[model samples]
Target: MTADPTTGISSFDPQRALALAADTFQNEAEALLAIRAGLDASFADVVRLMLSCRGRVVVMGMGKSGHVGRKIAATLASTGTPAMFVHPGEASHGDLGMVTLQDVVMAISNSGESDELNVIVPVLKRLNVPLVAMTGRAGSTLARHADHVLLCAVEREACPLNLAPTTSTTAQMAMGDALAVALLDARGFHEQDFARSHPGGALGRKLLMHVRDLMRSGDDLPRVAPDARFLQMLHEMSAKGLGFTAVVDAEDRVQGIFTDGDLRRLIERGTDLRAFHAGDVMHRQPRCVRDDVLAVEAAAVMEQHRVTSVLVVDAQGRLVGAINSNDLMRAKVI
Candidate 1:
């Protein structure tokens, strides 16, 4: 008996659809848990092999596994492992030339019998390239030929028909992530290395940038002698446009700071500004950070103290530069 697909077009069941979606999640989660529990020393062996590789890790897959393989390659590359994804179909047509004796190959296939992948296994072996197979069939030909095997077997697909690559592909991705993480830990890869690889984004800015990199230094730094008149300090602050100016001593050490906010406060109190000097009007012990401090940490100091700007000082407390919320925003470090 054939049930016409058109027959159910007018009887959509929202509850049934929701229930099926939840079932898919539960099924995939269980598969991941199973794989996690089944992990063994083979996982460590593969990590060691990859960690000691003299060249890149070439990843290969077909169909849905190919998509997952690309993501895995990207994660590995960003996390300090040199890796690239090659299509298995292309490998038979000379892309296999990209694989070298010095490199390692990781092939992903849920069935452990991808014709495109299996066809090239012999070529890889002939070239003396180490083959790591990520597959579900431990006894299958791909596994038997592999130097190492990452078993990703799932009881069944998340598809109600049990024919789609649903839970199986999820398991492959998780296994890839596990390998990449372990390899990174073995190599001692850290956040700064990640930031260096991802230099175009906000994460890179926050991790790789320091206050000295973004601060206004040399003549751009606004500083005035402590004996300078209040009007002279205001002119210095206005010219530099950092919302404040540092009051320094004869030795160029930071004595205090004066800001536009202080000016406003003085005006509101009707204080005569003509009689004031930088030393008299400046707020002593103003917020300051070292030039070597991370820009994100400087942003924290500003936020914690409710200030818009901070002085950048050297080891001797001499004003070397200045940074503010605007500087951090411009650099995308906050």
Candidate 2:
């Protein structure tokens, strides 16, 4: 049975339901492809203009385009492009004063004719500031007034009524992302640079946090000498609370490591704990990292080697500290 068109109450029509969802995706995809084709040397022009701006790249739009512009501005700012969004309506009222000859403006309008934006374009021109217009209408007033043009036309809206700004907005968003990424690459923005803009997030922790920042050092480290009894290593592991203990030589160079897994395996083998020493029951080449390594990289080492804990070392390969899954979790880099 066919589903109700008005309320969209389906009567279990699998083919129709799938087609409905697929059509929206297909339309949006086609719109994005059209934008990709529409991009030309003008894209390079805008990028060069933006790169030359000593001040911020100011973004402006109206309605749905405004929302997209704001996101675009934010993306640009975070990716090292130095950008901000100014509401076109507000610009006409007073915000137009924010525009300087040092700045570049990116204005978006599907129709290429927002009055609020139009009112401010003349002021920008008078200030000799470059304006790049993103619009579907090539012959639009906004396009005619702009110093450069970026076309964002769509074949049709994804909306069944062909009225809502669905496909057009998607195209705009994709274009903004593309532009931001292009600028990011041009500026040679690195992971550390990205982390600087997002210091409070997991990515920041991953990029900026070091192994020493989260490792158990000094007395906090679970350590036992190679000649130490298995019972002594167990006591050290428990006292340190890292579920494992490293076996080191007299010079404090790591010899091996004994973990909870080692204990379990030894117990399953019916070996007498009292009979074994640290050197006899420990993993000689345990997964280990340096104190100065990125904590995220340490976590990756642990994961790739399938270990719960890693011994932290120094330049001389001597045991200095230790870290485990718990430390990574505490640092939010897991």
Candidate 3:
């Protein structure tokens, strides 16, 4: 073990650090559970007020609570609720203009006595905006002016010094998450709605991606007539580079599929490739999906059936497109 020059001892102890971390985690977990049990009808009141507000939810806080408030606002905004964070100190210095009578204000302070926040309470009150307080003390100055109060008081702090904002901040963060999620559920926000807010994210790619967006259509789709010779199916599969070709009927309806694996198995058996037709060697009842189906669903279908590719069929069960595992990989859905 390396010695610490500063402490004149071992640089670090893994067991000691892990044990302490576990203690901190347990303390924070207990704090969140306590807050959960303390939640009452007032939590619903906060949601109802936010829902009715015509303007955005303006979250205000000081110190560590401010960091949590910013995340809370982001979560709310992304989950269908329009929200933004305004530092309490900035609000006093003209950022208060961001808060309108149409908006709702949520002030957060562990002790609920932040001077910067108290300075603007009257202005918010005079503007006739609805006020909500997330604080540990119910009777704090900020809470008294608030139309609704969410108790975020923790029994103890996780900090060894018992003075740091560890457990209290954790409780505040958990409460904010709970409130935002409740609002999300009440609004019936679906994954698609969430995807729109996060269009550049992986979730958006998974939820909003459709088979039509990634499928190989027209000439890109490998297709051959059912009566085509087995050698001709191989030519189509090789030309399209999809490892498979759909055997279609006269009206473009899919009859079956011929893949590279089928050719390998046929060659292994010394089958007469020259005489065999595509219909005779193709796998009947190939898995097919609609163009509008989610790409994630297509991936699920592939995984479930252990196939590398699937045919995309139209409304009348006619083959219109094809997609392989490579397409999903490019789209980052798989």
Candidate number achieving the greatest TM-score relative to the actual structure: 1
Please give, for residues 1-334, the per-residue lDDT of candidate 1 as tens digits: 3345878545667887899999999999999999999999999999999999999999999999999999999999999999999999988998888888899999999989999999999998888899999999999889999999999999999999999899999999999999889988989999889899999888898988999999999999899998898889989999988888999998888899999999999999999999989999999999999998889999999999999899999888888999989989988887
Q: What is every candidate's alpha-carbon RMSD to the true fold? A: 2.4, 3.8, 3.0
- My TM-score estimates for the predictions, one after another, are 0.93, 0.82, 0.88
| Candidate 2: tens digits of C-alpha lDDT, residues 39-86 | 899999888888888999999999999999999999999999989999
Screening candidate 1 with a backbone cut-off below 3 angstroms (N, C-alpha, C), the clashing residue pairs are none
How are the candidates ranked when ordered by lDDT, highest leading? Answer: 1, 3, 2
- TM-score of candidate 3 on Cα atoms, chains taken together: 0.88
Superposed model 2: Cα runs more than 4 Å off: 1-23, 190-192, 199-205, 226-232, 249-251, 261-285, 330-332
Backbone clash count, each prediction separately: 0, 0, 0
User: What lDDT would candidate 1 get against the real structure?
Assistant: 0.92
lDDT score for residue 64 of model 3: 93
Worst 10 residues of 1 by lDDT: 1-10
Q: Deviation in angstroms for 185 in model 3?
A: 2.6
Compose the digit string of candidate 3's lDDT tens values, residues 1-334: 5888888898778987898799999999988888888889999999999988899999989989999999999999999999999998988888898888899999899899999999999988899999999999999999998999999998778877889999998888888888889999999999999999997789999999999999999999999998998778888899999899999999999999988898889889987789889989999999999999999999999999999999999999999999889999999998
Task: Identify the runs in model 3 with alpha carbons over 4 angstroms from their true place.
Answer: 1-19, 200-203
Count steric clashes of candidate 1.
Answer: 0
Q: How many backbone clashes does candidate 3 have?
A: 0
* Better candidate by lDDT, 1 or 2: 1
